[model samples]
Structures are given as structure tokens and as C-alpha cells.
Target: MIKFDGIAAFVATAEAGSISAASRRLGLAKSVVSERLAELERILGTKLIQRTTRKLSLTENGQTFLPRAQRILREADEAAAELAARSGKLAGPLRLSAPVSFGILHLAPALTKFIQEHPQIEVSVELDDRFVDAAAGGFDAVLRHGAIGDSRLIARRLATSRRLLVASPAYLEREGHPASIDELQHHCGILYSMREGDWRFSTEHGWQVVRPKAALRANNGLVMREAAMAGLGITLLPTFFIHEAVKSGVLVPIDVGARAEGAELFITYPRDHGASAKIRALADSLQRSFGNPPYWDRLAS
Candidate 1:
């Protein structure tokens, strides 16, 4: 009979390049890792690795065993995950990631309420504009706006984010509003530096591109909204962050006749996390909070 622990240690040592490295990764002592590997070699009646002062090299038999060992470990993990899913009890740390603006305006409040419900679950959220690697970074879920590039991830549409060309009524009165997309060249624009140097729009007439002279450039969307509200210039913004401002008459939409390409909000996680109770609970709570046609979609309508 082959011992699973010995096989796991052998695989880890192979992947990590040494017993010491494997021990660090597995949270075990180097001696334990070495003992497991030796036991595995004894069972197989073959020396799997040649330990040298300079490096660790795998023998021919080790090369053949590596793939099989990894497969077995993966299968065992999958089986454990399936069993955990069937139990239906969520009790672990759940890591999440989201964009800066949306995370603050929408997701933060919703998460606060959900955490109150599941007090046992520890939640950690990372807010940034860049996309997070959910699997590698240990994030259980991510809330994202705009297009998702990776085909490996499964995305569930949580909301529709309408990007409106808007400015304060005071700014419109003082500088005159852009009646058409072409007229934007005459007005000062608040540019988001990360969106590249130009603004691309999809209209009924096909695609139109504009590169307006920016009076102020900002990396953060909230600051851009503030700049626009302070009568700086016209800015393209998502409804999710500006819904309250639009309703309260702080900001008014401009060039409404020519609409820009609206972005979508997705609640995405690894396909593997689908079976995790903690991930599922958080996802369900989020859907309940923001998924009913979404608040942003309602605002746009």
C-alpha cells in the first residue's frame, strides 16, 4: 500500500527543488519532509533524487513518478473540496478584490451587512484598479467592472454599469455643454490616465474616437468626479459611483444623444471556488444586495 502523505511530500520536494524549500511551503520541518521522501523511495525500491552539494536532481524514475504524484494530489484535493461543499457550512477566511471606486461606494456597505450575518467568517478585501489573480493571490472572489480578459475565469453578471459623459450644471452653464461628441474638443476634459490617451465610443453611426485636451488628469475615479463637480470639465463616469450625484442634481449628463459603450459588473471567482461554502455564501449575499437588475442599471433607466 502506498502512503499518501509520503507521495505528497515527494511531489512537494520535487516542485520546490529541495526538502528545505518544501518544508517552508508545507509548514513542516525539513527532517519530516526528508523522512517522507525516503519512505516513498523505500516503498518503490528506487532512489528518486540525487542530492548534491550544489543542487537537487531527479533520477529517471523520479521524472516518471512526478506527473503521477501531482495527478494523485490534485484528485485528492478535488475529492476533499467536493465533500466540503456537500456539508454546506461556511467557516473560513474569504478573500476578495474589487475596483477602488465601486468597492467603496457599493461593495463596502454590502459586505459590512454580510459580515454581520456571518460573524465566524473572516473577510479580507483588496481594492485596486488592476485585475487580481484570484487563484494565485488566494482571493476567493472578485467584483469587477468592464471587460474580463481571462477565459479561464467564470463570470456572473451582477450589474450593468453605464458610463455617462457628465459634468456639473454650473460647469455646463459657464463653459457651455457639448451638444455632440465632436464638440467635446472645445471643452476641457477630465481624463482618467489609465484609460489610455483617447476616449473611444460606440454609437449608432459606428465607432467614434476623441482625444480632448485635458485640463486635469487623475488616476482615481472619485477624484475625477470631484473635479467635474467643482466645474473643472466634462468627464466620463460610471453610474455606480455617480448615481447619488446625478439624482441630487450635483452632476448632469452631457451629450446624452450619443451614448458611450457601457461597462458590465461581474462577480467572478475561480471555477474551483464554486464548490466552497464560504465563497458561495459571500456570492449569494452579494447577489441579494446588488444583483436585482443592479442599482446602476436602475439609475441609467
Candidate 2:
């Protein structure tokens, strides 16, 4: 009979290239990982890894077996999760990756609430704003806003994030408030993820585009928000990111005769996984938590 723990240890050691590294990655002691590897080799009557003074390398058998071992582990995990879900008590691990700002501001709370509801669920999260390969990262799903550009992943719309033009009261007091879109264009703007252009809004007439002077630019929405709060310049950002500041009167909304284009928040998973039971449970939790129009939108109103 093949044991999963041994296979897992072998796979980790093979991929990590050293027992010590695998131990840290798997949260197991080096001796334990070594013992598991030896036991698996004993069962198969083959030496899997070559250990030397300087380095470790996989034998041909180990190289051939690595992919199959990984597949088995994945299947075993999926089976356990599916059984738990069918019984109406989801369990096991659910790993995800998300944008740093959304992960900190919104996703973290929702995850906490769900975990509290299901104590047996073990979750691992990676919060980053960069585009990452979900499969390569080994995340069960990803939380994202904007286009899912990867055809390899399936996405579920969680909510619509509406962007609004905003500035600190101090910024408005310093720079003078812009009463219309035309006037708003005259003010230098804090931009997110773009170097040359600034604002894009939807108005009663049509889509309106403006290229304001770039007061500051960054890849992160939080950076732009912080810049706006520091009275650097007016910024158009999502309500979720700025709602609390706006509600606290630290930032004020500007009616610039158009609505800044926002994005649809999505919870996506690799298409190969086919929306596993555990992933569905997490998605449902997020959808319920966000709600229609989202809580942030209501608060901003």
C-alpha cells in the first residue's frame, strides 16, 4: 500500500532540491523528511534521490515518478475536499492569491468570517498586486478585479467596484475644487498603473477621456490613495479603497460630470480544477459577503 505522506515528502524534496529546504517548505523536520523518503525508496526497492557532500539530485526513477506523485497528491486532496463538501461540512485546505490592497482591505475580513464559520478549513493566502501564474503558484483560486485575461482560468463575478473622483479636503482647499469634467482635467491627477494618461469616465453623453498632468503614478492603488490623502492631487479610485476615508471626511468626492470607469471584481480558479467543491464554498462566502452594490458602495452613498 502506498502512503500519501511518503509520496508528499519525496515530491517536496525533489522539487526543493534538498531535504533541509523541503523540511522548511513542508513544516517537517529534516530527519522526518529523510525518513519518509527512505521508507518510500524501501517500498519501491529503488533509490530515488542521490545525496552527496555538496548537493542533492534526483535519480532517473525519481525524475520519472515526480509528476505522478504530484498528481496523486492533488487527486487525494480533491477527493477529501469533495467528500467533505457533499456532506455539507467543507474541510481541508483552500489556498488563494489576491491583490495586496483588496486582500488586506476586503478579502482578509471575508476569509476570517468564513474560517470562523468553518474551523476545520485550513487556508493559505498570498497577497500580491502583480500578475502571477495561478497554476505555477499552486493557488486553488485567485481574487482579482478587472479582466481575467488568462483563458486557462474560470472566473466568477463577485461585485462591481465603482470608481469615484476624490481628493482630500486639504487638496481641494489648496488646489481649488474642479466643478466639472473639463475643469477636473486641468488639475494634475494621481494615476494608477499608467504613465501617460489619467482619467476615463462614463457620462450621459458618452465615454469621456482626459489626460491630466501626472502628479504621481504607481502600480498600486493604495499608493495612489495615500498620495491623494496627503493632498498631493485629485485621484479617481474605487469606492472600496476610498470609502472609509471619504466617510471620515479625510477625502471628499468630486462630481466631475462623469463616473470614472471601474471594474468587475472576480474570484477565479484554474480551469483544469473545474470549480472544485471547496473553491465553490469560498466563492459563495465572498459573494454573500460583498452583497448587491457592495457594502462599500452603500457606505460611500
Query: What TM-scores do the predictions have?
Result: 0.70, 0.84
For residues 1-301, write the lDDT of model 2, one tens digit per residue: 6678999899788766789988987899999999999999999989889999999998999888886886676677789988887788878877788999888999899999889877788898989888867654556788887878888888899898788899998889888989888997689888886434547778888888887888988988899999999999988888999989989999999986677887689888777667877787788888889889899898888
Evaluate model 2: give its lDDT: 0.84
Candidate 2, residue 64: how far the Cα is off, in Å: 8.2
How does model 2 score by TM-score?
Answer: 0.84
Residue-level lDDT tens digits of model 1 in 155-253: 777777778888999999998978887788888999888777446687887978777889899878899999999999998887887878888889998
> Model 2, stretches more than 4 Å misplaced?
1-3, 10-21, 34-70, 194-198, 203-206
The CA lDDT of each predicted structure is: 0.78, 0.84
Candidate 1 Cα errors over 4 Å, as ranges: 1-88, 271-275, 299-301
Evaluated against the true structure, the overall lDDT of model 1 is 0.78
Superposed by TM-score, candidate 2 places the C-alpha of residue 150 at a distance from the truth, in angstroms, of 0.8
RMSD of each: 6.0, 3.5
